[model samples]
Target: MHDQARHGGAYIRIHVTKQGFDPLTQRLRWSDLEQVLDTGPFPDEGPTTDDPILDGVSYSFQVTAPGRTGRHIVYAVWRAGHADQNYYMCSDVRFPGGAPDPTTPPPSPPAPNDGCTAAYTPPGQWTGVSRAR
Candidate 1:
């Protein structure tokens, strides 16, 4: 999903709900995951601006489901300035290729100690703010 601040700018953080993780009932730490982008105080107003600074910037990242598949949730938390207020949104996505066949047994969950971490590396540098048309 694509979004931008309409009034005061904000610092954005991205987080994904792990396959077995329950974001509704469980407490989530927004700082633990890697941030996809930090727009600082003035992010490009998406495609609405005539000469958007980050118009061409594209973000990509990989997610691991760990024996689970179907749909997952991604959260974007935008914290405006340094105030105590925080804004958040959720996007539900389905994995490619749809669900596994019913005849096929589901994969076993990994052992408690078997876990891995994935990091996102930005593909290009941000060119900072530009005059909005």
Candidate 2:
């Protein structure tokens, strides 16, 4: 998403609903909203028009789907800092497995010092884009 030179950053709010999104009526009301997934006050990473897949700054989040195997609609709202205008989008996703067990704890992480060395070299520096491998 493009920031369009907004000031502070952006706030990202994500909601999910089991109800299907109507293409003709591309608007959602508060009653149609279901679960609130993520709300982020993230840093400004500039425009993603420059190959977002290669080196775009982003925030990763995990969401809990409602059921085991069904389709769901995820709605994302982007509110720019110090701005009243907001951008909205809807995405359809299908789940293959049953719901996760909330009682089960997540797996442990790997050790910090696992005998790994770090080395990186940038391919080239563009006029306004910078990246590290």
Candidate 3:
């Protein structure tokens, strides 16, 4: 990702590779891309893949980032040529911290809780079953 600190904007570069025969030159279309910050959704208008994408080449396009420092999610989708095959990618990025370390394991799940609670019970029929206690 290219950090445009001066312009207060950023861009992401994607490298695509194909194993088999290369397809004819076709326009690359970006279906959708969304950035969700801690505050709310941040929208960005990126470039279209009009350039001929040769095998094993990199493509870069402008992207938007949140101003505040916090974890963010970027959802992106694109399609090549006129094929029905659609490519989808999601990225979990953090401002000021950058991307998470791949070596580190993901955080564990939160502890489970029962659905029923004292607040849900009637006033007269107190179960006296305080889960906290």
Off by over 4 Å in 2: 1-10, 19-29, 46-56, 97-133
Per-model TM-score on C-alpha atoms: 0.38, 0.46, 0.32
Off by over 4 Å in 1: 1-5, 19-40, 44-46, 49-69, 82-84, 97-133
lDDT value, residue 73 of candidate 3: 42
Q: Which sequence of candidate numbers ranks them by TM-score, best first?
A: 2, 1, 3
Whole-model lDDT, model 1: 0.52
By TM-score, the better pick of 2 and 3 is: 2
**Alpha-carbon local distance difference test for all models:** 0.52, 0.60, 0.37
TM-score of 3: 0.32
lDDT of 2 by residue, 28-87 (tens): 566666666655576665445465445544445666655435445678888766667678
Candidate 3: which stretches are off by over 4 Å? 1-55, 97-133
For residues 42-116, write the lDDT of model 1, one tens digit per residue. Answer: 443434434475333222335444443555566777675545567888776665544443675555555576568
Q: Write the per-residue lDDT of candidate 3 for residues 24-103, one digit (tens) a residue.
A: 22222233222332212122323333444422233455554535343444555443333344455655445464344457
Error of 2 at 86 (Å): 0.4
- Scored by TM-score, the top model is 2
